[model samples]
Target: MSDGANLRGRFITFEGGEGVGKSTQIRLLESRLRAAGLDVVVTREPGGSQRAETIREYILGGGARALGPMAEALLFSAARIDHIDSLIRPALQAGKWVLCDRFADSTRAYQGANGKLGDDVMQALEQVTLAGVRPDLTLVLDMPPAIGLQRAASRRAAGAPADRFESEGLGFHARLRKAFHQIANAEPRRCVIVNADRTAPEVGADIFRIVDERLGDAAPAPAITR
Candidate 1:
């Protein structure tokens, strides 16, 4: 059902570990796209549609910690199904640029890399859940785990606590960074690594340049068939 008609609009995803400014860069790109008079729909995985948001809440509520990696991946896939059907598919079919904060890559990194997940399981989930919809381009905001964690902790609201993933130790985050690097290396065309340690404006400028250059480039090599 998610294999809607082929789309003309671009699908861009911003991916990174906690507090790597994925949200900030997304805003910058969205603003540029709107200024150029394009229709853009911004959404986030595991929490885009109403049902998906419920899954996000449960997953971040601390109870799901006890659940194994496979169970967690299933929950994320369930949310992704609702999100693609209810929000992502329609936006793409209508020819609106889709900007998502995190997509399947996050699942692969957080649950797959950091947890007990294998590539076979991750790939199969993608084939089923995505149903041939993959990002035209993915911006991987790369940064050290220690720096990112510090930034994330500082950004948290006063009196608020870190989420389950955020509360993870430094070692977990180091591997998470490597996991993202692996994804970028595997899909060179679809993935671009951006240094997230720089100032927000500097990072924003780098992203804007890449968007301008890459968006006008050729389409992503066919990864999933329609």
Candidate 2:
């Protein structure tokens, strides 16, 4: 059901660890796309619209303690269902560019990598949960786990609670970083690794360049069919 369709719009996903600047990059890309007069829909995974946002608080907040790995994965899948139905799929059908912060890749990293669940389990869950949905291009911002954690802590100092994942020790985050790297290595065509240690503007420029390359020298196809 989520097979690539003749999409007039491009689906670009920003993926990364806790503090790798996924939010900043997504905003940068959305702004750039809009500046060019492209129809753009900016959204995020685990939470996007009203209902999904509620689920996000539960999953990311202290409530995660009540949910086991399977439960947690299911909750994410549920949120994604709402996200795609309410946001992603509709925007793609209308030929509006969709810039998403995080997607199924997070599941693989957090649940598959950090959760100690094998790739097979994660892949299977994705198949069933997502109905074969996949991003056209995924920009993964990569950085050291230590640095990312520090950045996350700093950002959350007064914003909100650190949550279960954020509260996790450095070793857990290291595994997450490794998991993201493995995804990039395995899916080179769809996943690009952007070093996030650079200045924000520079990182933004890299993202823009990557999208341009993906869109190619010619105009994008009127319809994108998988």
Candidate 3:
């Protein structure tokens, strides 16, 4: 591996409120990149590793009941630290292209918007927890909160019951959507907005085009299809 190979590693994050289909787009993008022969790693925050997954269960299962806002923020950061150390950093050091479903932005959105924790707290948390880990590019799946909530409701009805956050009302979800848009507006250089109201395949193609242009024509490496 030469300098180019070492520099090939990229951290790309997909961001959105619940039901914006970040997971679906991540899968589609990973598949496309793999077909093109690039070493791609797909992972998510709050549950990228066993330990983090445990924390994720706690958070989503409403186990964070006793935790105050600051404590809750710390818990999320703790999971993120473990996720970065155990998964994200290793994959990137191996020269793999990483696709993350959600990342620090979600914290700023949920904690800041809903918790009303303030941006300074979120920024400081990012500094200490992530140690300056920032995505090379962030694709924001933009959609109205009402539509997103409907999608989530339909999916939940078809699948398992709604999680704690999923049980939040439309107003809460609307705040989350606003937070995501605010984040993109605040950091245009690193974020690109994709209208997710379109069909899945169309949205997937938009994501692939952005990634393809950035990663160039290199073929992606093999991945264990899920």
Candidate 4:
């Protein structure tokens, strides 16, 4: 993994509407990459570093929803700035692949497209928050909104309440799905839309194959064992 100290690590982000199995896919990919002798750092947006997590709690806990999408977008960007500086950039600089559950694309989808914030504001926020850092690959997990919401509800059935985004109406999620597809279409080189309605193992296999095909050269040599 450390064969090339100067080599910058790859950044991959998983994106989707509610309950699209992003967390599960991220875990699966992390395991595969680690087994292949790559140093992997798994993180998530709205919260990755400490300060960002605090922002995450506030935003998801419904504190920012009432303030409108613009406020939420700003908060998300603030968290992202901290996340990039505190955790993500450092890990990548050390040659560790960063698998993020969500990133700026979420803001683009939820706030810009669905929230009706317009492209100008979204572009400005993206410029400020991301600087020059962008994901090398983004796996947009595509699935029906109704089915995804059902899965989300099931996951939250253990006496856990839905978060701000999760509590949105079905129409909101439908638009969110469309927004993600639009993003994938706009940046085909950096984004791949994966059908996420299948089983975890099946989805994992496809994701691994995509990673190997697209980034095999950058991956570290598997560790030798006796």
Candidate 5:
């Protein structure tokens, strides 16, 4: 296809503490983008590419629970490297909008905020892993930690297990939530704070509005239905 056939892809990521509904909103946004007849690629991290997915399984399974924050950061960085090379970059280069459920912001929040890893270390990891491939927009779904934890708990099936991050104490989750807002405040231009402690449709609508405003002509035609 000619260059005129597709616009340069937009890299958009959704970030927040656990159960803020990044997955659901990504799906909604993907549907809306598809409805508008755009090529949208939906993915997530610390998985997306094969290696990353394997890393995700280990990390989220709590198998890596004993590892220190710095160690965990290194693992995530390694996964991100594969994900970028194998999936994210190629999709973007092909002029497909990439909507990610979580990105680097997740690392900064989950590990740097509550864990031993510091901001300097996290930033360095990002520099190495991202290789300058930053998201065009990041929508942070914000809500109370307690509420989010409850929601996350309710999602589990009977006898199911909680992930390492999800099993963190209330204090840790609270700190994680604060870190995300800090990130948004630090980068107001690239990040939008969405109140996610509401109904699915309400939160989704707010997200779509922010996306529409930032993306302008590039966003889907007509406003998002939900």
Candidate 6:
């Protein structure tokens, strides 16, 4: 039910800081879509494809941190290129709704905002990497950085150190939240800000409603009986 009805698939990306429960909600939404008799492909950025997963390991393992933000952004873009080529594009062409955990917006928020990369640079990278393919809808889960970090910490295994981004201080996360808000504000039609402080079911219900309102009408109609 994408605006690009000719593409035969809808792309929905979830954006938020760490511990916003994107993975959980993606699974819930996937199940709902399956129950609704739609083919769905759930994937994640920086790791969706086999080659991209290699990049994900290196970047998340803190190997790319010292290389600086610009380098990190380049690496993420490289991964995304492979991800789209190897997985996302094929599935969409096959008429499967694609639910991606994170996408270019994360790069815009994390690298562009925190790394001080200008909008021009970000736009250039997006143009090269995306090549006209973009999510039909983006869900930005909103919550305080303090609460989100605490939730992130609680979910981690004992003595398991934080990943590159998660290890950052509260100020970094606060800025991340602000950046996501700015993205939603700038693109009201393509992005929706959903409060993440509530229970999962509550959040899921709201998400479903939004999805239904936006894309449900475009779902393929059922066949009539003879």
Error of 4 at 99 (Å): 0.3
**Least lDDT summed over 10 consecutive residues: which range in candidate 5?**
1-10
* Candidates sorted on TM-score, descending: 6, 4, 1, 5, 2, 3
Kindly report which residue stretches of model 6 are placed more than 4 angstroms away from their true locations once superposed. Answer: 1-6, 221-226
The lDDT per prediction is 0.87, 0.81, 0.82, 0.90, 0.85, 0.90
The TM-score that candidate 2 achieves is 0.91
TM-score to true structure, per model: 0.93, 0.91, 0.89, 0.94, 0.92, 0.95
lDDT of 6 by residue, 1-226 (tens): 1233346678999999999989989998888888787888999988999999999999999999999999999999999999988888888888888999999999999999989999999999998898777999999998899898989999999999999999999999999999999999999999999999999999999889888877786555331111
Candidate 2 lDDT, 1-226, residue by residue in tens: 4564554567888888888998888887777766666777888878988889998988888586566776778788889888887788778878778888899999888887787778788877887766645688999998888888888888775767788788888888888888999999999999999999888999988887888887633224332211
Clashing pairs in 6: none
lDDT of 5 by residue, 151-176 (tens): 99999998888888888899898889
For each candidate, how many residue pairs have backbone atoms clashing (under 3 Å)? 0, 4, 8, 0, 0, 0
Worst 10 residues of 4 by lDDT: 1-10
lDDT at 120, model 6: 99
Candidate 2, after superposition: displacement of residue 117 in Å? Answer: 1.6
lDDT string, candidate 4, 97-154, tens digits: 9999899999999999999999999999988888777898999999999999999999
Indicate which candidate wins on TM-score: 6
- Stronger candidate by lDDT (3 vs 5): 5
Residue 38's lDDT within candidate 5 is 77
Clash-forming residue pairs, model 1: none
Cα RMSD to the true fold for all candidates: 4.7, 3.5, 4.4, 3.9, 3.6, 3.7
Model 5 residue runs over 4 Å out of place are: 1-7, 219-226
